[model samples]
Target chain A: MTNPTAAMLVIGDEILSGRTRDSNMHHLARELTLRGIDLRESRVVSDDHDGIVAAVRALAAAHDHVFTSGGIGPTHDDITAEAVAAAMDTPIGVRDDARGILAAHYEARGVELNAARLRMARIPDGATLIDNPVSAAPGFSLRNVHVMAGVPRIFEAMLAGLLPSIPGGRPVLSQSVRVERGEGDVAEPLADLAKAHPALSIGSYPFSENGVTGTNIVIRGAEGAEIEAALVQLSERFGA
Target chain B: MTNPTAAMLVIGDEILSGRTRDSNMHHLARELTLRGIDLRESRVVSDDHDGIVAAVRALAAAHDHVFTSGGIGPTHDDITAEAVAAAMDTPIGVRDDARGILAAHYEARGVELNAARLRMARIPDGATLIDNPVSAAPGFSLRNVHVMAGVPRIFEAMLAGLLPSIPGGRPVLSQSVRVERGEGDVAEPLADLAKAHPALSIGSYPFSENGVTGTNIVIRGAEGAEIEAALVQLSERFGA
Candidate 1:
């Protein structure tokens, strides 16, 4: 099959309250696209244990692969690992491999490995460690769920490590034409174009500029040439 | 009791395939924050009936309100309304109110109210209508699930219409200070500041530019003055 399905679970209270702009979702979406893994669903849950557990269980069962970000830190609110364990009905404890990684990191930095730091060493049972080049604490994978750190740098590094281990499908391709016209003016034509390209996905994103509206018509498909042809047609019809 | 918990369900295959960039989540996050409703979770599921049905049930049970976007269009890929009906075990049919609104819209545009267009009017039974001012294909709310159109303009207009009917809590307030320093350099002091403010939520988002790293320290709480005080303390510690 050319379509490999995946989902994302983002766990953090900061993101929920608009206290932070989530960059990880965009990064993951792009990375997964490059890997030809269709990131079918993404969920952002708070640090609440029950919420995390429920989302994990639901997403894991539905998607072929599930990637989670956030709540794996040493802070009081970080609870993804435990929640994942609870959701899977599996045991969770500090594993030797994860502990060794944390210990070596703290040792190199010459900082005392406190109880809070040791919290990062805990992993769900039957999970394999995913190395983090940017940070010492490791992410892990159990069954279909890939648990990574919430911090963007650590998350990206962990994803890099994990992507290579999974098989991917054919990459999706996209082409865009920026039209200096309002979507209201282009809606009919765009709708007609979309209908003609039954196998392709087309979207018109409108933006306002200095009281004038413009639309960016994007055509996407698994075939690059088809997207290119659509782009050419769109430009010929509506491009400035 | 004043803090309302909410979740967003984005149903579409375009998002999962990276064919579309999700703008609705960010908009909902901002709108919910202003309304004092905590948007604790967001899920993006595909056009699949099972996935949407499962996500709707899980989120509605866990949240005070669940808002779903997409899959309510006129196309075959649009299956959210049906999925929601299946999830709630309610029969799906063209709502009288919704059909009137959509028919009026088509009439105004001198377009035929075709079968495909009627597809947009088929809503779950016993749901309240949410008016879409931009397009007039009204969304509906069943229990706590508020279904809205996928198009940004239409979705936003529908949200504006629905926001007033829903009760909200005290809005979250935040203040931020950008410090041109690494996370490790500021973590300890920031942690202390966080400890001092028991009611406030403090987060450190670190970034890099031109090989120089910096952290944007955010202090958020219900009290404006408390957040301002935290910002002052943060500036005193690390401000340029």
Candidate 2:
């Protein structure tokens, strides 16, 4: 059986406007890849309420699990919670459980908990909280949709807590042979091998550095033996 | 008028699988942001044929301009050219002009141009070639969709040629104030400012480093003076 597929929804105008370079997607990808979960698709959307709601609904339907980062915070722009609620068609409110956690967190730090701060306690119906060890404001999982904070550290923390609970298939393994030849020179044999092994994902990543160009052929599949065999065939065929 | 909306399609299983960090999206986002094009959305899909075609068609139709990265090389896995053709419903073949460029490029370096190398000459009908200065295999622009190589250097080089040709609106201007307070403390004022200035995009990004947490309030809009005014108001309200 194939690994459970996942889709990531990254929300923020900062990411879209290029004000910030996103690192969370790369982090999540690596984590999921190690777990053997198939991360099939990822989308970055602006922090518009309707747009986020639609994206959540669409991705949640298409993939086995949907992980959203960003728009969950204690701010005016932090509309992810409400938008997620709208997407799931569930009522959201400041839950006593979540509020107790926040109250304790703020009390320990001597920080005042105002209406805006309480916004973090507004959890959608029937959702389980994803712990935030970095911060007290918790992320939540509503069905298959795991909503987490946008901050890289918090996102990583929440994911560490959430992933262990989800069922993951055998970790997909990969091996690569970096050919010193240009992609054009290596395309023929590479294509032939790909055709022979239909189950594996063979990727041709071209690189150009110091005025020289070459391709890195990465062979990926669930079976370690299959990947090793493909690597052997590739090395012999390319004669690299 | 608002800036022209654009979407980026990153076609690669490597990116989805977390084997390769996708740099093209960030590179494209920065370029579009500077050119005053609103990069509203970006999607990373696997190297699947039908998925690539559907993503191309969807993004091309939704945005004024669509840029696709990866899957344009000469490998068997490089199916972007054909998929793009199918998406636009145009016939694709090894064009003489494209072949001539490839042939000249190979001949100059004394490299053999074989059948696999010739695959680089395949161009969609009626599409204008996007110059790749780093390597000879040109990216193509069919209507609003611009298909470029996935490699960061090549993609940037192609963009330098392609963006100037496309119509861009006024460049977006932005200013940020780093507030030494948590996001909870800044949300109320942020929401007020966002409501007051509906035209501008005000983002509150939080950070935690060395056990200290702070928020960076960024105000973005087309007008410089407007951003200045917003920054002044934010400074006054936050008293930071």
For model 2, state the Cα shift of residue A52 in Å: 0.9
Candidate 2, residues A1-240, lDDT tens digits: the string is 878999999999888888888888999999999888888899999989998999899989988999999998888778898999999999999998899999999999899999989999999999999999988899999998999999998899999999999999889888888778888788888888888888888888877678667888888888888888888888788776
- For candidate 2, write residues B12-114 as lDDT tens digits: 9888888889888998899899999999999999989999988898899889999999988888888999999999999999999999999999999999999
Looking at model 1 chain A, report the run of 10 residues with the lowest lDDT sum.
A181-190
Most DockQ-accurate candidate: 2
Predictions in order: chain A TM-score: 0.93, 0.97
lDDT of 1 by residue, B20-89 (tens): 6778887888999998998988888877899899889988998899998997766556678899988988
The fnat of each candidate, in order, is: 0.37, 0.88
Query: lDDT per model, in order?
Result: 0.82, 0.90
TM-score of chain B of 2: 0.98
Reference-based TM-score, model 2: 0.97
Candidate 1 lDDT, A19-76, residue by residue in tens: 6667787788888888788887788887789989888998899789999998776655
**Where does model 1 exceed 4 Å of error?**
A1-4, A33-36, A85-126, A169-240, B89-92, B177-199, B210-214, B224-240
